[model samples]
Each structure stands twice: as C-alpha cells, then as structure tokens.
Target chain A: MNNRLKILRAERDWSQATLAVHLDVSRQAVNAIETGKHDPSLPLAFRIARLFDLSIEEIFHDQN
Target chain B: MTKIDATHNLSESAPSSVLRKVLITIIGGLTAVFSIAFLAGYTVAVTEQGGLNAYAIGTIAAGLGLIGLTVFISYKLWPKGTHEAVPAREKKSQHILWAAVVIGVLLGGYMAVASGDNPDGVFSNEPVTASFAVISIATWLIIVPIITWMWWRTIDEHEADAYREGALVSAHVYIFLAPTWWMAARAGWAPQQDPMIVLVIVSIVWSIVWLYRKYA
Candidate 1:
C-alpha cells in the first residue's frame, strides 16, 4: 500500500509530528504508514481521510 | 513558527538536543552490553560449559563491535533538535516504563553481585534472609504485575500489535524447543532442560522481534 501522507503533510506545511498529534498517534506510527511499512487500521484510515477532508481512496492507493 | 513547529526544527543543534543524544547513546550502549552478557551467560549455562570459550569471546567481540557501529550510525543520523511533540499522557507513560526498567536492571545487578559466593549464582538454593525474600517476592509478584498492566494499558495500538506478534513467535519457539530438549534429555542425548534458560531465550527472541516490528 502507498499513501500520499507525506505529500499531504508537506502541502499543509505540517511535520510528521504535527500530523501525528492531530491523529493522536506516535510520530513513528505516522512515519511507518507514510513509508508503506504499516497500513492504518480502518478507524485510523477514516481519521486520516477526515483530517485531510478527502476520501480514503484519494489519500491511499494500492500498489497494483 | 507555531509552538509545535518550533519543536520540529532539527537544524537548530540546541544544547538540550545534544544532551538527549548523549543520554540515548549511553543508555543504548548499556542495554546492548547487558543483553549480550545475559545471552552469553545463558548460552554457557545451556551448554554446561565451565567458562567462556573462543566462540563466546568472538561473539561478544562481534556484538560489541556491532553496537559501536549502531551508535555511530544513530549519532550521525539523529537530528540535533527535532524531537517531535508527544502528548503529555503518553510522555508520562514512557517515563514510568523507563523507570521500571531501570529499577529492574539495577536490582538484578545487585542480586548477581550479592550472590557472588553462591555456587548457583543469583539462582542459588541457599536460603535468603526473611526480609530479603519478602522484598524479592513483593517486587516480582506484586509490583511487576501492576507495572505490566499499566504498560499494556498505556501503549498504542501499533505497539500492542508488535508485542502480540513477538509473543506469538516466541511462544511457538518455546512450544517446539521445550519438548525437543526434554525428549533429548530422556534419551541421554542432551542435558536436562532448565526452565530459567528457556525463559531467558524466549524473552530475548520476543524482544528482538518486537523491536524489529516496531522500528523496522
């Protein structure tokens, strides 16, 4: 899985830590998701979607 | 910059950040040394060896060398002043965990040194004074459970998942290992299994896997 999390954060001028705080997660968690080492759970995905005011599909995409 | 933005600048090279790096390096180095020593001791015990052999020395040397390399790399890569803001509640939880770990390691080291005269070292069958036994039991049976419960409750979902995966892998290893060692002992092909050694090995495996999942 790949996501535009880094790009999204950068667009908003938000550091990983800033986004992590918004999501109530560790910065490491945000980094892992951004790097594709971890996939967000459904609830987290929803949160991320809500945060960016975009659908989950707009933020995250399957590699295939 | 906003307050949060101020906290995220890694290029500052602040005095506080320098102190943090030094502290991290010291703690990480000590942890690596302790882990290696603990594993080496158990390896010798499990093999029924009398002393450190060439292999043990080589392993220790390699492990220390690796630790040195890791420290160097971490130092090089770490930002000078870029610690991200952790929520206050989560920060408190982290402090408690570190305090517990430090206490545990100190107590363990004290026990090993104090039991120097005992043939079986810290696990000797020799009777301890009543007060010592009470203190030890209280720490292990009461304080440990409370701390463990707090730890489980405080960790985030990612950490919980890492712990679960680590436990699963270690449990499988133990399931196969204990039985094989027992059967071998029965057939006079190996020494009897020691529960303590088995526990240590399993714990090490769990820690390794958990760290990998969390960081890698």
Candidate 2:
C-alpha cells in the first residue's frame, strides 16, 4: 500500500512524533505506514481518516 | 521546498551537528567493543575458575556501555520537553519494561555468582541447588507469564501484529526443522536432537523476526 501520510504530515507541519501522539500510536508505527512497510488496521485507518478529514482512499492507494 | 532543502543542508553542515555525529559514532564504537569483549570473557570463563567474577566484570563494562548509548539516543530523540505528551499508558509500559530489564540483569548476576562451578547450573538441566531451582522456576514460570500478559495489554496494534507474525514464523520453523533433525539423528548424520538447542534456535528466530518487524 502506498500512502500520502508523509505529504499530509508535512502539509500540517507535523513531525512523525507529533503525528504519532495525535493518532495514539508509536512514532515507528507512523514511519512504517509512511514507508509502505505496514498497513494500518481498519480502526486505525479510520482514526487517520478522521484526523485528516479525508477518506481512506484519499490517503492510501492499493498497490494491486 | 528549495528553502527547506537548503535549511536541511545548512543544519547538516553545522559544527554542533558534526560534533554530535562524531560523539555518537565514538560511543557506538565503544559499545560494540565492550559487547564483543563481554562475549569473549564469558567464553574464557567457561574453562576457568572464578567464572562468576569474570561475568560480573564483563557485565559491568557492557552494561555501562549500553546505558551510555541508550541515554545518548534517548536524549537525541526526545529532546527536553517532547516526551511530556506521551500517553500515560505508554509511559507506564516503558517503566515496566525498564524495571523488567533491571530485574533480569540482577537475576543474571545472582545466577552467575550462585551457580559457581556446578556443571549443571548455567547450561544444563540438572538442578544446581534447591534455592536456585526455586528462584529460577519462580522467575520463568510465574513472573514471566504475568509480565508477558502485561506487555501484551500495554502494546499497540502494530507491536501486537509484529509479535503474532514472529510467533507464526517461529512455529513453522520448529515444525519443519524438528522432524528433519530427528531423522538425521537416527541416520547418524547428526547428533541426537536436543530439545534445549531446538528451543534456543526457535527463540532466536522469533526474536529476530519480532525486532525486524517492529523496528525495520
């Protein structure tokens, strides 16, 4: 999965640690998601979507 | 974007940044040297008297080096006030984990000293003493389970997922490897399959997977 998390975070002027705090996840988790190494769970994806006021499809694109 | 890139380049070339990098590299090198020396000392101690003493000395040196590295990394990563926003549960979990590590290190020191020259102590299944057996059994069978439960509860979904994947891979490896080793032992192509060695291999594989998934 590819994500616009890094760009979104940058637009908000938020560091990974700051974004992690907002999402109640570890900084490493945010990094992994941004680097396309791990996909967020449904609830976490929803949280991310809510945080950015955007749909899941807007932030993430399926590789397939 | 160009301004940001220029700023990043300027920061990288700063004297303080250069000094910090140099210090980190030096400390990292020292930590590696201490770790290697600790392992070498342990190997030598196996064939010599006062193995406990050697272990104590090695532990101190390695422990100090590790502590220094950990402190430096934490300082560099968290800065001063950045950690204040960490969730209460996360802070509690970190505390518990640190306490566990301290307890484990203390227990290891006790075992090294108490085991002495008992061939059955550190490496073998044979009981060293009644007290040693009690402590070891209590720590591994009771305390460990409780700590593991707490850890599982405190960790986020990402860590839990990593742990699950590690467990799955480790189980698969054990299933295939154990049967192969058993057949090889029967054919006299290898030594008899030792349960302890199998357990160690499984554990190492599990830990490698877990760390890679969690950190990489």
Candidate 3:
C-alpha cells in the first residue's frame, strides 16, 4: 500500500514522531506506514484520516 | 500543493536496515545459545554436586526480591489512564519476563536433578526437601505463564507480527533440526539430543529473531 502520509505530515510541518504521538502509536509505526513497509489497520487508518482531516481514500491508495 | 517525495527515500534506507536486522538476529541467537547451554549444564553440575548452601539460598532470595521490587516500582509508575505506549514500562515488562524465564528454568532444572534419593548421598532429595517440587510447580506453571501473558499484552501490533514471524521460523527450524538430529544420533555419529536443550534452543532462536525484527 502506498500512502500520502509523508506529504500530509510534511504539509503540517509534523515529524514522524509528532504524528506518532498524536496518533497514539510509536514513531516506528508511523515510519513503517509512511515507507509502505506496513499498511495501517482499519482503526489506525481511520485515526490517521481523523488526524489529517481527510478521508482514508485521500491519504492512501492501492498500488496494484 | 507540491509533494515533498519523502517515500522515495525509504528504498535507499531499507537494504541497510535489513542487513542490520539480520546481523542483530544472528548475534542474539548465538548469545542465547551460549547462555542457555551454559546455564543448563551448570544447573546439572550443581545438582550432581548435591547440597545447596547459604549462598545459593541468599542469591535466590535477593534476586527474587529485587525483581519483585523493580516490577512493583514500574507498575506504580505506569502511565495512568493512557493507552499509548510507554517505553519505560514496556522495557520493565521485558525485563520481568526474561527474569522469570531464566530464573524459572534454572530453578526448575536444579529441582528436577535434585529430586529423589541420591545413592551417592552428595545431595539426597529427602521428604523434607520436597519444597523444590512446590517451587517448581508454582514458578514454572503459574508464575511463568502469568508473567508471559502480562508481557504479551504490553506489546503493540508490530511486535506481535515480529513474534509471529519469529515463532514461525523457530518452528520450521525444529522440524528440520529434530529429525536430522535423531538420524545423526541413530547413526552413532552424534550424541543423543536432550529434549530440554532443544526446547531452550528453539525459544532462544524465536526470541532473538523476534527482538531483532521488532527493534532493528
């Protein structure tokens, strides 16, 4: 899965750690999602969407 | 809005990260093997030698007391009403779990060897020394599992994934190792493999891989 997490985070001038703290997760979790090494769970995706004030579809995209 | 292209950099960092993970896992696995084997052997030697002195009793008491104190302190300091990760709390949980495992194994192994009457009288497991049985039962069956559950609950999804992956690798390792080991022993080319030793090895391998994958 590919995500616009990095762009979204950068737009708000938020570091990965900042995003992770706000999301109630580890910085590693945020980095994993951003690097496409891991896809967020449904609840986590929803949390991300809520954090960025955007829909999940707007933030994440299918690679295939 | 212009994209900053942060994702592209992950590819550049990934190979090095993978290599580091592999290296750590290998190192951790080797460390586990040596530590576990040496402890198991030492426990055997101690039991064969027989009588437990004041030093052994004092060491056990002091160690268990210290662990209890540490666990209590960490639990007291745990973040209140917050579901977020607390690194210190998690580390404490890890420490508690390892202490339980190592101590439990050593004590249990010693108790097992010390059990029953020794013809040599180096250490006779008389009726009065039956306390080893109770300690073994409580520590191995009750305390260990309870601490293991507590430790398991403290981890997030990523750590759970790492554990699952590590377990899978260890399980596969056993499937190959045990049968080959049996064949080798049967052929008289190798010493018979101790089930306890093998179990310890599997656990060590799993932990090493799991920890490396989680932290690295």
Candidate 4:
C-alpha cells in the first residue's frame, strides 16, 4: 500500500506524534503507515481518512 | 520557527517508521546477551550445589538482571520525537517482563524451601518441602495461563504476521529464550548445575546464527 500520509500530514503541519495522538495509536504506527512499511487495518484506515477529511482512496492507493 | 512548527518539521525529517526495526533489533540483541550471561553464571553455581535449589536462585537472579538492563537501556536510548507509533504488541512485551518477574520471585521462594536455607525469616530452617512443592505447582499454573492470555489479548493479526516473518529472519532467536527457560527448569539434564546454562548456549548459538544470516 502506498499512502500520501506524509504529504497530507505535512500540509496540516501536524507532527507524527500529534497525528498519532489524534489517531489513538503509537507514533511508530503512524510512521510505519506513512513509509509504506505497514498497512493499516480497515478500521484504522477509515480513522485516518476521517481525520484528514478525505476519502480512503485519496490517502491510500493500491500498489498492485 | 515556532515550537509547534518545529515539532512538525522534525517529524517530517525522520519519520517514526524507520525506528521500529532498529528498536526491535537492539532490544532483541540485549535480551539475547542478558539471557546467556545470567544462564552461564547460574549453571556454574547449580553444578556446585548439586540440587534444584541453586538452579532456582540463578534463574531468579538472571530474570531480575534482565529487567534492570532493559530499564537502563530504555533510559539511555530514549529516542527523539514523538513515540505515537508504538504497536499494541509493545504492551505484550511489557506484560511479559512483569510475568518474568513474577516467575522469578515465586521460584526463588520455592527454592528457599527446597534447600532449607532461608537466611533470615520466621520460617528459616523450617522444613518446607510440601510448601515448596505446592508453590512450584501453583507458579507453573499461573505463569502459563498469564502468558497465554497476554499473547492472545495483545498480539493482533498484523503484529502476529510481522512477528512470523521477523522470527524466520532472526532464526527464531527471540522465541528461543522462553523455551530454553522452560527446558532448563524441567529437564533433568544435570541436577547439580543450573540448567540455565542450556539457555545460555541456546542464546549464543541463536545470536551467531542470526548474525550470520543478517550479515552474510
């Protein structure tokens, strides 16, 4: 999975820690997702999308 | 730059994702070394004593030492930036540490009875063979269930998948410690020497194998 989490977070001027707090996850988790090292679960994906007020497809795209 | 903006800038420069692998490796390495040293010392002491009692003390000491080392390392390596990315599995790791402590204390108490060598206490010198037996049974029952519950509750599907992949790469170095600990206690390989030596050898061998695979 590839995500624009970095770009989106950058635009919002939110630190990973701050974003993680909003998402109720550890900062490491947010980093993993942003770097494409990890893919969030459906629930977490929805949470992220909701936080950014964007559709899931806007933040995450299928690499395949 | 404003402090809030500075925080954002720092977050962008080096994201939290990069640190997970590094932290796991460091922690795994530390755990491996600590297990080996403590087990070796324990085995030697047990061999001289010629009983299960010595083995118990050695195990307890090693468990305590590892906990101390973990705390020290965490304090020293306190990473910069927010730590929001911590996986839920980290909670299981913490619980495991507490479980280890509980096991150590219970075992130590049992050993004190088995050896009839209580240094200072009202029960000192009292024959506690039955008490030791009962306690040992109880401890085993409690520890296993607690570990199972913790694993089930804390490890999500994703973390479990990651663990499986990482375990293969590390040649199961991290997983071997628990089994080795159990074997040392249950196996009657050498009654006099602490069986923890077995754990030490296992950790060393695993470490070597992990390094070989990693570097080669």
Best by lDDT: 1
lDDT of 3 by residue, A1-64 (tens): 8999987887776655557668766555666788887778899899899988999999999987
- Segments of candidate 2 deviating more than 4 angstroms: B1-90, B118-120
iRMS of every model, one decimal? 5.1, 5.9, 6.3, 5.5
How far residue B95's Cα lies from its native spot in candidate 3, in Å, is 7.3
lDDT by residue (B1-216, candidate 3, tens digit) is 333344234323433443453454344433443333444444445556885677765654554455455456545643344223334544565477567656755663454345423322212324535576687677878877888788777665666777898999999989988998999999998888778667878988997888666555
lDDT of 1 at A57: 99
Which of candidates 2 and 3 is the stronger one according to lDDT? 2
Give residue B144's lDDT in candidate 4 (0 to 100). 66
Model 1: per-residue Cα lDDT over B71-111, one tens digit each: 67777755554455775545766777776767676666555
Model 1 chain A poorest 10 in a row by lDDT? A23-32
- Candidate 4 scores a chain A TM-score of 0.95
* Real A-B contacts recovered, model 4: 0.29
Q: lDDT: which is higher, 1 or 4?
A: 1
lDDT-best of 1 and 3: 1
Residue B78 displacement in candidate 3 (angstroms): 21
**Cα deviation of A47 in candidate 3 (Å)?**
1.8
Candidate 3: C-alpha lDDT = 0.63
Whole-model lDDT values for every prediction: 0.71, 0.69, 0.63, 0.60
